[model samples]
Target: MTPIVVPVPGVFPYEQLGFTNCVRHGDVLYLSGVASLDAQGQVIGDDIDAQTVQTYENIGRILAAGGSSLDRILQMTSFVVDLGRNGGGYVATRARILKQPTYTSAVIGVSALMMTGLLVEVQCCAAVSN
Candidate 1:
């Protein structure tokens, strides 16, 4: 199968950041990390809950661009700068978004992300029915 590069508008400035949002090969989409950023690639918020929610929304949009959806996600990896402070809330928000607990996931703490005030960055792999 040919690999398709799915365009996710406002995900990031690819010309500057040099990262693709998601690449679909066959039914699986390998998604790159996404955060709560606006169309201009600027960090959107300071609150973790708001960032987490926006991150999921961005992920859902990217997945949809790749002929997939949130429910098709099989795995996810999250990086958080303030895990101790936002861990519980982030997970709770994620649980609300996914609406299920049957997916593989891993969370890692970090000193910082590429952008300031970016509390979390989430990446996932999903299946698409194309």
Candidate 2:
């Protein structure tokens, strides 16, 4: 099936950067790695916990725009900078936000991300409703 780009309002212009925020194909939604970026692509948070919250907020917006929700998430991969220091915070914050650990997920260590202050980037997939 053909993929359709999902339009998320108030998100940064990832299109100009040669990528889309989310796309739907058949019953599945694929999201690019979402960071705590504002409308201008500036990092929004100072630390891992705050950035993890903002990252999930961004993911929620994109998933909703694609006819999905965080509850429908099938899998997620989080790229984290400074895994030794920030990994626990990222996990704890994610647990608080999600409430249920229902989705398949992994957190990977990385040296850096797209932006200087970015501590986490979440790439996700979910089931879109018919």
Candidate 3:
């Protein structure tokens, strides 16, 4: 099993957090939960709409680095801090980012996230052909 790690310039060192961006075992790519953080590792956006966009963009970069794409995504799990206000917003944003047939997904509402003002987090699984 070969593990793949996608490192964005100036992104936080995941080792301190005890995780990698993505891990590849055979053809399957497992991505860690991604937050809407900028290159400086600071959370971005003021609302769910903006945060969701950044989250998807981070996922896109990871997929591309792992030799995959959004179309190859097999599963997605999203966590939202405010289910009532931002849940639908995340889905609507995803629909625009991922225009292809939707993959299996789970949206969970939680009391809070690791950071303040952080509304959403997303993780995904993708399979790439050799």
* Most accurate candidate by TM-score: 2
TM-score of 2: 0.96
Give the per-residue lDDT of model 1 (tens digit) for 39-126. 7878887888899989998888888888889998999999998789888888888888989766799999888998888999998999
Local distance difference test scores for all models: 0.86, 0.90, 0.83
TM-score of each: 0.93, 0.96, 0.89
Query: Positional deviation of 22 in candidate 1, in angstroms?
Result: 0.8
In candidate 3, what are the lDDT values of residues 1-130, reduced to their tens digit?
5565655434444556788888877788888888898766788998999999988888877777777888899999999997998899988998998898658999999989887889999989998745
Candidate 3 Cα RMSD (Å):
1.8
Candidate 3 or 1, higher lDDT: 1
Question: Candidate 3 at residue 46, lDDT?
Answer: 87
**Model 2 lDDT per residue over 24-110, tens place:** 888999999999998788889899988988888889888888888888899999999999999999999999898877789999999
Ten-residue stretch with the least lDDT total in model 3: 6-15
Q: Which regions of candidate 3 are displaced past 4 Å?
A: 2-11
| Residue 31, model 1: Cα distance from true site in angstroms | 0.9
